[model samples]
Structure formats: C-alpha cells, structure tokens
Target: MTLPDGGQSPDALRSGTGGGSWDGERSGRGLSEREPFDLLVTGGRVIDPASGRDEIAAVGIRAGSIAYVGPVPDRAAAYSRRTIDATGQVVAPGFIDLHSHAQTISGGRLQALDGVTTALELEGGALPVADHYRYAEDQGRVINFGMSASWSSARMCVLDQAPAVRPQDDPRFRLPLAMFDQFQNGPRWQSAADDAQESKIVGLVERQIAAGAIGIGVLQGYAPGSRLSEQHLLGRLAEQVGQPLFVHARSMAPAGPGNAVDAAHELIDTAELTGAHVHLCHLNSTSGRRADRVTTDWATAQRSGLRLTAEAYPFHAGSTVIGAAFLDPEVLARDGISTRSVIYLATGERVADADRLLELRETDPGALCILETFDLDDPQQLALLLTAVTFGDAAIASDAMPLTYTGPAPRSGTDHSERALAALTGDVWPLPDGLIAHLRTSGCFARALRWLVRDLGVLDLVEVIRRCTILPATILAAAAPAMQRKGRLSVGADADLTIFDPDRVQPAGDYTRLAPSIGFSHVIVAGTPVVDGGDLVPDAFPGRAIRGSAG
Candidate 1:
C-alpha cells in the first residue's frame, strides 16, 4: 500500500511505505484485516504542507487519525463507512489561528464556517489558566482551543487588586475590557512595579504556565507608561520555562521615543538578552503606516539568529477598547489619527472632537471601538499594510474580538449579575442581530485567501496555506509538542482538514451586516466532521485542549 505523501516516491503509482498507527494520544487503532475504514475523502487535491505534496489523492481516517492517503482506485467500495465526494474542492490542513480572543462557542461556530479548526488566544490570553481550561471543557467548544498565560491579567491581579474571577465567583466582579481599564482611575496602570511586586506577578504567571498555559502573553501596549523592567523579567521567565512570550509591543506613536520602531527593537533586544522566543503580535495595525520599516527591522533581526516571529491580520483597521493608552489625545495627534477615524460600537458614534473622545474614555472606559488606521483605496497605504501581511513566513492570525450583543440582557434564563461573563463565554448560537465585533471574527482567513492570492496575486494558494498551518504549528512546537500532530495532512496526522472551492471561498461579513464566511464544504476536527456539506453538525464537538508541556 502507498503512504499519504503520494506513495513516498515521485510517482503516485509506486508504493513506498505502508500505513500504521502512530501517536496514541490522537489516533484510534492501526489498520487491520478485520476492521473497515472509518471515513474516506476522495476525488480531491490534497495539499500537505508538512510533506510538500500537492496532488489528487484520497485520505482515509480511522479513530481520529489519518491512516492512509493515496490514489484510491475503488473510491466508496474500498471503504464501507462514510465517504465525502470532494470532486471540485481543495483539501488542506485546517487553518490554525495563532492569535484570537473569540473563546466562546458562538465564536468557534463563526470561525468553523471560515475554515478554522483550531483558534488560540495567545495575544490577550486568560488568567488562572486552569480555570479557563475547566470552563471551556465544561462548556464544550466547537473547535480545538487554548490560551497563553496573560501577563496583564496577572498584573491587575497583583497591582490593581482586581478580582481574578468571573462574575459567577463574586457579586461585585466585572470583566475589564483591557488592562488599564481594569479600574477607571487606577494608578497601577502607569506605575512601575516594585521589586517585590514584580516577583509576585512573575510567580502568578509561572503558576499559570504550570497549570497549562501555552506561553506568556505580554500585553504591555495597554499600559505603555508601565516600566520595562517587569517585561525584561517576564522574558527571562519565559526562557527558563521554554515557552515563547507573545508580545503586544509597548506604544504605537509615530516618531517619538516609544514609537513602533523602538518597540520592535525592544522585543528583538529582549529576545537577544534573555534567550527567549518572542512573538510580535498584530504587526499590521501595531506598526501603523511604518510597516515597511518595522518588518524590515524584524526580518534583519531574524537573520541574525534571534528567536523572533510575528503575526498579522489582513485588515487595515483595528479593534480595541476606547481607553487604550495610545488613544490619548496627544499621542493620537502626533500620529495624525483624527478623532473621526475612531467609531464607537455601542453608540455607533464617531468622536466629534477631543473633548467627546475624552468624555467617552472617562465615562465608558471599557467600551469597544474601531480605529481605521489605513485607507485601502489609497495604493500607498494599502501597500504599507501588505508589507506586514506578506512578510517572510509570518502567520496570518485573526485577532478576533469577542462577540457582543448591544441589546439589553435577556429577561429569562439569565441573571442580571452574570450578564457580562455569560455573553463572553455563552453558547448563544445563531447570533442575534445588532451583535458587534470586527468583521475579522468571521472573515479573516477567507479574506486573506481572496485578497492575497486571487485578487493581488501576491502569494500562491500553497504558500498561504503554509502560513495558516505548518508555520503557526512550528511556532508553538517547543511549548506544546501536541501541535506537531496538527496543521498537516499525513498518514499519522490528526484528521483536521479544511475542504473548500478556491473560486467560491469568499468572506461575506462586513461592518454593517456581520455574516459568517461561506464556501467551506467540510471542516473536520480530529476525526469527526463538525461542518458537513457546508452545514454545521449540531452535535459534533471533537475539539481537544492544547496545553504547554509543563502541565
């Protein structure tokens, strides 16, 4: 029998290696004379980035692991179980999101329609990693999920004395939108940590890592006035634990001491000094119009043997809470960010002036807003954004924000006190109208395929698939070896696959009407098909937890 990578030799007719069971954690059983194949996908072009093979093939699955991939002569008759006729589709490894904040069942459903099988919260991760995992397990996710150890969450837990629990745990608890907004006027956001306080914060993060956080999430950009010494210490901690530090660099000012360029250097310097794997998050919006220079600097550093990587979403605008440190009037003025460029999602109001912006910041510091950083119509600005998206081997992450319903809380089956956390992690399906989130939540991958490969011709389909799969999996391989089994289609790899029509796969979501992207025929997680024939399987929950080795 032939193997998954087109029978091991250049010719598909030749048989090089036989299929057998591997990786007991994910696989079910070995191929045997008595057992029948569980599922067979036939008549499609299989693109396996890990093996560098792209050809027409059939994939056989048994017990959640791929058992065989070759030219199936008998098609359905060879396998008595389930069969998928992917006649006009491309079967590729399911997209892996390296940075996502949509950790709810509703969010997972939206992402599944966009061809994602795994979505990780590495940029703004969760605190008390164990609790996060427990909650997700109890709720049952639609796709494989994980998170990093949130440094900002740990900081607030220590410095601001914020309650580190959901509203379910305490009557007075509230879900802070971002780091500095944990408290309306808290001084801890701007103050440096004392030696003891820094040690305490480090201990909290370390404990969470041991509890199964994939890495450390450094959201220093939200608290730009905070000291750098704490970040240096965190870098050292990540190196010691062999986990990468997912960093949102401090400050996005245009041309000052704490500009994006300086922040890029700081990350590179920290990687060099501490010997840690530092991941720069959201290079597109964070680097603003200077993406060309920032990407060049990072590429040079990477060539110099520094352990650094970056991710960027395709959109020119960014979504965050209104109280971000960079949204200060002076900083915005220096960067030429007009007040009109920012739109409040709750009220659908564009800030008329600096006074209105400050009033909103003071009154509803945790409100969500969208910042238009670039005009796609302008060729120069569009090219600047593309510079980051097309950077050498950079992963394309969604940076998907949490879904929110601006309407009043439901009167039945919902407690007034538990409204915030409930909506954040609820199983609300068929999301109600007036739900507000960035279009990236449901359209990032489809949009990337549409814009980068088909429209602009900047990259090929195979290269974009690599960025979505193997590259992101390789980035986290050191911390979570389980990822090595994901992001590819091979004999022993987990049966997580995305099958779609190249011409038809297009993002349907927009600012006014937020709809799920269409065109994925099937999305398999592990061995089960969560999306079958372009429809969601209501009962399929085959997602598994991805955790750090320290756990």
Candidate 2:
C-alpha cells in the first residue's frame, strides 16, 4: 500500500494533509508548551481504520485519550513521560471482540496478549447486568468489558429458576459456561413460555437493560421451544429501547426446523417487521455450507434499509454443550453429522457412537464438545467463507471461551488483586490440562491476520483492521455511544492500541495445546500499558465498563 503522498517517508506522510485531522499548533514549539504526554509511540505505521489513515506517524497519549497524531518534530520528543520506538510495527486500534465469552481474569490476560483490548459477551449475554458488572469490577478486569442481557437467562428467571451468576468465591469465574449449560439442559430450555411467563421474561429484559446492558442477547438454537412470536416480541422490545438484538440463530442444519437458510430468514423477517438492528452471531457455524446465500440475503436486507449485520469466527469447528436441543438425535441426523464427529473437550476423545453421545448428554450435559462441521482445514473453503464475510461487511469475532484456573485464595486484598500479583510474579497458574482446549479462544485475530493478509493475501492490513476494529465499534456505538471513542486512532479517541510486527504475527496453538499468539510487541488500554515489551503488566486493570445508552 502506497502512502497518500508521492513518498513513503515518515516526514512526507505525517506532514502531508491526508485523512487525519492534524494539529498544526501541536506540531512544533507548541508541543513543548503543552502538558507532557503519558506515552509516546514513534516511528510506527499507524493505521486508523475510521479515518482511512495508514502511514508512518507518531501518536501521543495523555490521560487515557489520544492527544496527538502526526509527524514527530524534534522538540516534541521532550514532552513525554515514556517513548516507545515502534519501528517495523503496525500500530492500530486494539481489537474489540463482540462475541467473546472470555470474561475471566486469565481469559483477559490471554486476550490482552493476543492484542484484544475490549471483549464483550453479545451472544448468550449475562443476566442481571448490574451483578455481572459488579462482579467484574470487584474481581478486577485486565481489559474493557461489557455484556448484553441474555433472553435465555431471563427465560430461566421467569420459569422460577436461579439465573446463572458466577459465585463470588469461585476462582474460575465461568458463569458464562454455566449459563450455556442452563440453556442446554434445564427444563426451561425446552419449555415454551405461556402468556404470563412471556410477560415476565420481557419485564426481566427491560430491568436488565435499565441496569446497563449493552443490548439484548437471544440464543434461539438452545431454546427450540420458544415460539417465533416470542422472538418477535424480543425484537420489538429491542426496537423500543433503540438497542441491537444479538442472536445465535435457531439452527445450522441443512434441513428441517434447524435449516440455516430458514433461520436467516426468520431473523431477517424479525428485523424487518420490528425495525430492530439484528446481529447474527457465528455465521460460519450457523449457516454452514449455505453461508454464501445467507450473506447475499443479508446484503439484500441491508439495501432494503433493514438494520442487519453478522459476525464470523475464523475456525471451522464449533463448540457447544452436549445436551443442547439442536443436538437431539433427530436434529443431528438432519444435519447429517453423527456422534463420530464430536470431540470431547475435557478428555480430547471423540464420541464413538450414538449410544455414547446419548450417554454423555444424559450424564454430563454441561461438558463442552466440539463438532467438526466446516472442514476449516481445507484452505479453499476457509478462504471462500472469509471472502463472504468480508464482502458481506461482517465483523470478525473470536467467540472465545472462558479459561479455568485452580489455586489458593488470594493472600490479601481482592481476588483481582491476587491474580494481578500472580501475573506479575509469574506465579499465575493455568488449569492442569489448560484453561480452554481450542486455539480460537486465544488466537482468533492473529490467525485471521496471518491467513487472510500474510498467507492467502486476500485482504490488506487496513481492511482486516477495519473489520476487527471500526466495523464492530460502529455496530455497537449505534446503541452505546461510549463505544464511539474506541476502535479509532483519531485525536481525542481512547488510547487503546495494539502494536505488532506484521511480518511475524501468527497464531501458535491448535486443538491439542491452546496457546497465546506471538508478535504482539505492546498493547495499551486506556493509555496504560497492559502488555509492555511483549509482557503483561502485572496487576494492571485499566478496563472500565461499557454500558448502553439506556443505562
């Protein structure tokens, strides 16, 4: 990619009047008169997706906001607390994961290393939004966090069941996983809501939004008993509140009630009828071989002015609870997948037959199992799906799973403080086998960057950054204006950035051994260094909550 000017020199690119708004007064002696910056990043190829600026420039951060972005004059170097030489690196907005389930401390640490600064649960979101935020605040967070109000959780509450909440003393903080379990096997999962129950569920969702939920999360696949009328009601509620409705569509199978095409149709129809902005989660997994058609339909909806969008992970395999309604024998048969295709995450063993699959579902419904449905190993198919997402203007999200850990209670202070100390001292422990069994949880963005930009050469660096940053930011900012400050590098934007060597960045883990990606030189969150010199800053918790306008 050529710089906007005739030359590629840092001076030419920075001095030239291009995309970004330049502060001429702050360029020379004026910089010396201003307050010193908290941090200065110089000599990097700064790519701001929102402003369409991709060139070598210096960035100055002060008080957790971007203070300057332009050529660094000689005198400007004097006004900084710290300076980082970002030569041969790409400095862009830190990735924002819109569908992540990795809200725990360990999960945050791993995501930080992989260059994610913001991770939100938009699919199967938390119930009791206040409690979720309070728990995260009490425990401390390494990255910015937010969540939608879960319809599944509200349904459970309406049915008189305890909604999923991470026990305050539970070290792992796997409430999201527990929520999925509840949705999969609990009696309410297969019980349709009657007139009164539906009203209660809607009321609970309204309460959650009032408590600061980013939006409303609808996981229809796990709740087969839910009527289409229920979904429409939820859509109308979201529209009334001017918030997006994030949904895991009803099915992924090729035929029957779980067909991907039909599922897309239902979601699109809901959006059209209710005028709700709908976000389809995990298009690759939910749409399977028909993802292209779904993307086309989504495009048509967009042209029709229907508020619709979608997201997809890079991986081909998808994980879910064993007892999910969609996993019933008849449903599985319609999908043309058998038990032999299922791999247990806990033991790393494949389910041998239908009998064993049924046995596990009955015995341990909460255990996670991976289904190899997409054949992501085939580069061509992967590339095609990736192209579809890019063409469809869909954002890329990790859908990262939670990480588990076991250790003694913190010796002093809050749970977050102990974990921070452990991270700093190199004493933070991982689960015996691993926190998560899948590589996508830790390295989705890196893998996408490597395969899409470096290897396959299908997308340029700027385009990939746009999909990961500004695109998702724009989607969420419609409902939560606070997100407008994120996913950008313009002056006055939040100082959340990821610095990495483009040539060396790649994912290192796979199905067998989950590992963090490599080549993230530094990650800054809210103007604070969370990962300095490729190492996590112990006890650093600069993350703050991102709530919807309703809050």
Candidate 3:
C-alpha cells in the first residue's frame, strides 16, 4: 500500500524544483496573489471523479468555496491562513450518504470520522420537514444534514389520528426514528388507506415538499399492506414536482407479490406508469441473497432509460427496529433468514427460536436489532452481497441507524421509548457509556474503501470515489441545485472535502464493539474543518441546510 512517490517526504518532492523551505513561505509562480485562502491542503493525490483528475495537487479554500486547485510551491501554507499537510493521503470530495438516519450531534461526529460531510435521511425521512430542519438548525449539526418527506409519517398522521406536530419540548416530535415507537403498532402500519385518507396523505406530502423537503421518502416495507394505488398516486405527485421518491421496497418474502423481485417491479412499474424518478434505498439488505439477480434487472432497466438509481453499503448485516414487517417468522423463513440470525441490541443476544423473536417483537417492537442477512465468511455468499455494491453507477450509502443507550436496567415498553428519545436529543459528545449502534454509523465509508478497493480489488480508487461523491450529488442536484456545487474539486465548488490515508483507512469496529474510524486526516464542510488532524473539532458547526427548490 505504498503511496505515490514511494512514501517520500513532502520536502523531498518539493526539492525536485529547488523550492523554498517546508515552512511554506515561498509562493509558486503559477499561484495568484490577490488574497490569502482561508485554508489550504497540499501534497495529496487529488481525485475528482466528476472531472478525471487523479494526480498530486493542492487545494485552496476561500469564503466556504474552492478557490484554487493546482500545483503548489514547497511552501504550500503561503497560500492560506491555515494549512493541512495532506501528503501521502487521498483528497477527494467528501462522501455523501443518501440513507443515513443518524441525525444527532454525536452521530454526525462519528460519521465525520468516516469521511462523510453530508448525511441525509432519505429512506425514513421526517413528517414535518420544516420542523426537522428547524430543530437541526437550532442544535447546530456538525455535518450537513437534510431529509425527505416521509410517506410513513404522513400515513400515520392521517390513519392513526396522530398529531402532525407535537410541542417543542417533545424531542421525539422531530426525530423520525421515534415513529417506530410512538406509532409502531398504529392502524396505519397494517391498514390500507381509503380514498379520502389517501387524498389527505397526498396533501400532507405535498405540503412537506412546499416546506422544503428534498424529495419523498417511501418506507413501503413497513406498511406492506399499503395498496398499489397509493404508490401510484405518490409517484404521480413526485413526477409532477420533479422530485425523486426514495423508496424502501416491500418485504423480501420468497414468494407471492411481496417477494423481492416483485417489490423491485413495484417501483419500476410505478416509474413507467407515472414517469417519476425513483431511488431505491439499501438494495443490498433488501435484496438479501438475490442481490445479483436484482442488480442485473436494475442494470437492464437503467439501459432502457427509466429514471432509476440505487445505493448499497459494504456490510452483510442490517440494522432496524424489531417489529419491521419483513422480520416476521413466515417472511424470514421464506427468505432464508433464521431466527438465530437476529441479535437483540439491548442484551446482545441472538434470538434462539421463533418464540423468542415473537416475544421480543411483541414486548419491545421499537427496540433496535441486528440481522445478519449474508454470511460474509462464505465466499459464495460474500460475492452475492457484493453484487449490488459493485453494480454500475450505484452510490455507496450508509443506512446508519440512530444511536441509543441501554442503561443497566434495560427496561422495555415505555421505559425503552424514554431511553431512545433521550439518546436522540442528547448534546453530550464522546458519547456517554452504554450507547450502542450498528458499526455502519461510524465505519461504512472506511469499510467500503478497505474491502472493495484495497482488500478485494473489486473497484479502483477513482471509480469508488465516483460512487461516493459525484453520483449522489448528481442524483439530487436536479432537485437541490446547491448539490451542483458539491462532489467536485474544481474551483468555485463547495470546499467540503475529505483527506485520508488510503493505506491505513479501515473500519475500527466489529459486531461486538463500536468505535469511530481512524486514518482520516481531515474532513471539511463548507471550508470549516470539522475533523482536523484525525480529531473532531468540538465546537465546529459549519453544517447548513440543503433544501429543494419547491419551497
């Protein structure tokens, strides 16, 4: 894993041109001398997938945007007030996560360590989109954050008679994940909406878009009983508004209309019927062992010009609430998922039998759990898991879950909701003890680089960078114009960039432990260093809202 130039020092590289000292006082003749840049990064292999640049270069930031990107003199710091030595590292556009659910301050810190600058909750988005943004702005997020308008949230409000907005003091009101508890077993979960209810849900989603939601988040899997007519209506709405529908396709049951392939068709068919752009969320976990077949079908459809896109994470396991409809024994057995594969996060215990799984789901439906969908140790199973990830043009997104602390008591029922709610709104950094979440929250991007690029050699550095950066930016840029300036290293683009040692960047945690990744030298958001020199800047809050044009 030697870097370009055989691990030589930055000074050695500079000496080739007989440059000045490494202290960075000398300026290159090619550089401009108008105003000093706010920040500068030197001696890194700059890879901009958007443009085909993969060479040693320097980047200068000014006023929250990229001011310069070119060769620098030995004294690169002469161009900026603050400088970062990115020698032996890769400087690329900051990773964009299209499926993150970890919207809290502590959660964003963990993601920053993994090289992510923008993390959006597009799969299970919030109900009152404006409220979600307002709360995030008030709290001052560490990384950029945004969300879609949630179809599930709208349905619950209409069918379950739930309030559209709760009091400001109630932290659960703004956190979309809390809906898994507050309305987990509500009638909306298993009931199909009538004509009037469907019209009302459509109205609510439209209002959310007008409030600046980037798109529509359809958690179709949670409400498996939802009628196709409702999906058609929603797709039409998204098409009319020129926005995409981020959908979690229905259950992965092995047979019937709810099977994985059928679920894929549900989205494709809607797109064809309504001309709506559809973005599939977590194709790897939802497709299970059929990832290869599903990915191939998607590729074929993409060739035919249906407005479709997808994303995948590197891990074989997935995290979700215990009561997800797809986790039922009948559905699991049909899809080859055994009860033993499910592990309760509170107790860190594998479900012993169907009885235990049912009991847990009944008692604590909102509790978080991990399900190993593929046996990564087995070569054949591992290949199937990689199929979706390596598929052409697919973004690498972390379906990162929110963090929760299970105190010593580990209470169920109302107590569990209280603990989960507290974890979502807590401002404590360095995360209090007993907090646990899926490793993907902190390691998704690093693991993708380690396994897919370095270890397996399945993808090259530039290609992976394309998937992590520009591809996602392209997917949303049509609706959110601000994204047009992100995911690129050219001058005038946003200065949200990630610099990391490619040779050493890897996941620092496993199934049994949770820790932030290592080897990330710096992570900048809007020209501010949120993670600098491999450490989080405690008070940095440069994250800003990313909204759609409909507002």
For each candidate, what TM-score against the reference?
0.91, 0.89, 0.91
lDDT by residue for model 2 (1-551), tens: 22221112334335543222344323533365457889989899999878778888888888998877878656546879889989899999989999888777777888888899999988988876787788888777888999998888888767747655654644333454455565456666456888878888888888889988988989888886788888888899999999999999888877665478889999999999999999999888888777777788888989999999888887778777778777766677778887777887767778987788888889888777778776667876675576455666788898887543223445666566466434421326442333344677789899878988898787888888998998898898768877877898866678999999999998877776767789999999999998999888877989888898898
Q: Taking the tens digit of each residue's C-alpha lDDT, what string does model 3 give over 1-551? A: 21221122435435532122222322334454557889989889999887677888888888998767777666666667888888899999999999998988888999999999999988888877887798889888999988898889898888888776642558665566666467787755457989889999999999999999989999898898899999999999999999899999886654555678889988989998999999998988888777877888888888899999999999899999998888887778878788999999988899999999999988988888999988988998899888888888889999998875655654566454445445556666655556788999999999999889999999988888899998999899877777877887766578899999998999887766778998898999999999989999989999988888686
Let me know the TM-score candidate 2 reaches against the reference structure.
Answer: 0.89
Candidate whose lDDT is highest: 3
Candidate 2: stretches off by over 4 Å: 1-22, 25-29, 163-166, 169-174, 377-384, 404-433
Clashing pairs in 2: none
Per TM-score, what order, best first?
Answer: 3, 1, 2
Question: Each candidate's lDDT (Cα)?
Answer: 0.80, 0.78, 0.83
Winner on TM-score (2 vs 3): 3
Tell me which of candidates 2 and 3 scores higher on lDDT: 3
Model 1, 7-88: lDDT tens per residue? 2222321232333433311232333435666888888988878778788877878898787776654536546387888887
Predicted model with the maximum TM-score: 3
For model 2, state the Cα shift of residue 42 in Å. Answer: 0.4
Each candidate's number of clashing pairs is: 0, 0, 1
Residue 147 lDDT (model 2) = 91
Write the number of the candidate with greater TM-score, choosing between 1 and 2: 1
True lDDT of residue 28, candidate 3 = 34
Worst 10 residues of 3 by lDDT: 1-10
